[model samples]
Target: MDKFIETINWCSLRDIGFVGPRFTWLYRKSDGSQIRERLDGALVTSDWLNRFPSAKLFHLSSSASDHSPLSLRLVPKPRSRMAGKLFRFESMWLKEPRCAEIVQEAWGEGLREASSDVLGKCLESGDRNTRFFHAKASARYSKNLISGLMDAREVWQEEDSKVEEIVVDYYQTLFTSSNPSDFVELLQAVNPR
Candidate 1:
């Protein structure tokens, strides 16, 4: 048993994790003291971990078997999430007495430049506005603030969800090709007859 333990330790294998309830194994003694331990689980090597970094384990309710049967899966990599709806700050927060104090404290500490990139971007967008000038000494801005927004892009495609599926399918084939010739062939094949 000791040599077997050493061999497992030396192999550098790690147990896959589980979510939900903690214990997996249970035993009861004649005197009524119960024993519970995570006796059943799967382990993987470094190579397996790198290949399936998002792998997970789940604990299930015991039927006839004392220990939970485990499952393993390697999921396809997910695409980058589209920027969704804007989150609005609550007006009630400003009404509270502590609001001023909290704001002053946060302001005193000063936000890091890296943390305020989005805010800086919105502020800097002022320069992107087109300026119009007339020969008669009139300076007016001709910026259409709503241009290039989602509603404009979505007009080209009736189904918004299909756009991502199309993009993902297109890129997956191109990127997964191992050879240049294969990529070129795949690209040519994508065009309709």
Candidate 2:
């Protein structure tokens, strides 16, 4: 095992961490002695790690064999558009000791500026942006507006008068109970579990 690890180190291959059980192979003896070992995994080169920073190795349960199966998942690199330019993540950046500190500092500065800008805009406007608000309200109203409705007889209604009648009739029928006292009979008929 030491020599094997030395070979892996010499090859510059790294193990992509696993997600499931610690042991991949299980052995049980008739005398009630059992052995468990992690013998299966995935190894990746630095280039592959750079390309797939979000790669994952899963240890799947095995029912027919003592050795569990391994599943490798490679997540594609994510690209984001920031200020009309593309931003990409490099896995090698994680090796830098100050990467986390630099990112946190930049994020904190940006967040402070953005928060102040938004608060200033809101304070200055103070709901005076009537056209934008009205437009959004009108858009929601238009989207929620029912163009047509189907009647109980399966007739399509497009006219405003007919649509209103259908809606009113629906609510009236829904609220006006024909047999209000029937709930007692329903409760009695339900068998206790």
Candidate 3:
């Protein structure tokens, strides 16, 4: 068991956390003694998580088995009914000469630069409309505020220190890559003066 855990840590595989019952397995004895344990989970690498940020794992109920089944949903639930429509590929678009250019421009630096310039202009004129800018800033601050978070035990953490700790831990785990080898290679590639 220890070796298995060590190997999992060594490979940097993390559990793509699930929603539903806390325990996946339930054992009940005839003497009225019952034990519940979370023995099943979906382990995934950081790259898979990055590619599918909206992926979800759900613990489905079981009638015959001791362990509940896990359902993995790659696509997230749509916010609106219209958003749930299935996507269809248009073959005619392949025949368009400018299709490739349009696609490249959509993902290219040109759009990014334009958006940055707009934001820069807004900030430059922010002094002229101080109240408007202040209101916008206040609204963003309120929207981004972290009031509370749920802990590993599924308990809500509302205290200032606890909330801060949870937020920091979450970001740390999210940003930390599963593979350390890439970091080493990246560091070696940089020329130190």
Best model per TM-score: 3
RMSD of each: 24.6, 21.0, 19.3
lDDT of 1 by residue, 69-98 (tens): 665545633434436633434343444445
- The lDDT per prediction is 0.52, 0.66, 0.66
**Candidate 1: residue pairs that collide:** none
lDDT of 1: 0.52
Write down the lDDT that model 2 would get.
Answer: 0.66
Model 3, CA-based lDDT: 0.66
lDDT of 2 by residue, 95-184 (tens): 445557666775877643333333344445564653444444444543454555668886756567787899999999989968666588
Which structure is stronger by TM-score: 1 or 3?
Answer: 3
Candidate 1: where is the Cα deviation over 4 Å?
76-193
Ranked by lDDT from best down, the candidates are 3, 2, 1
- Candidate 3 at residue 42, lDDT? 88
lDDT of 3 by residue, 115-161 (tens): 33333444555546544454454445434444446787777565677
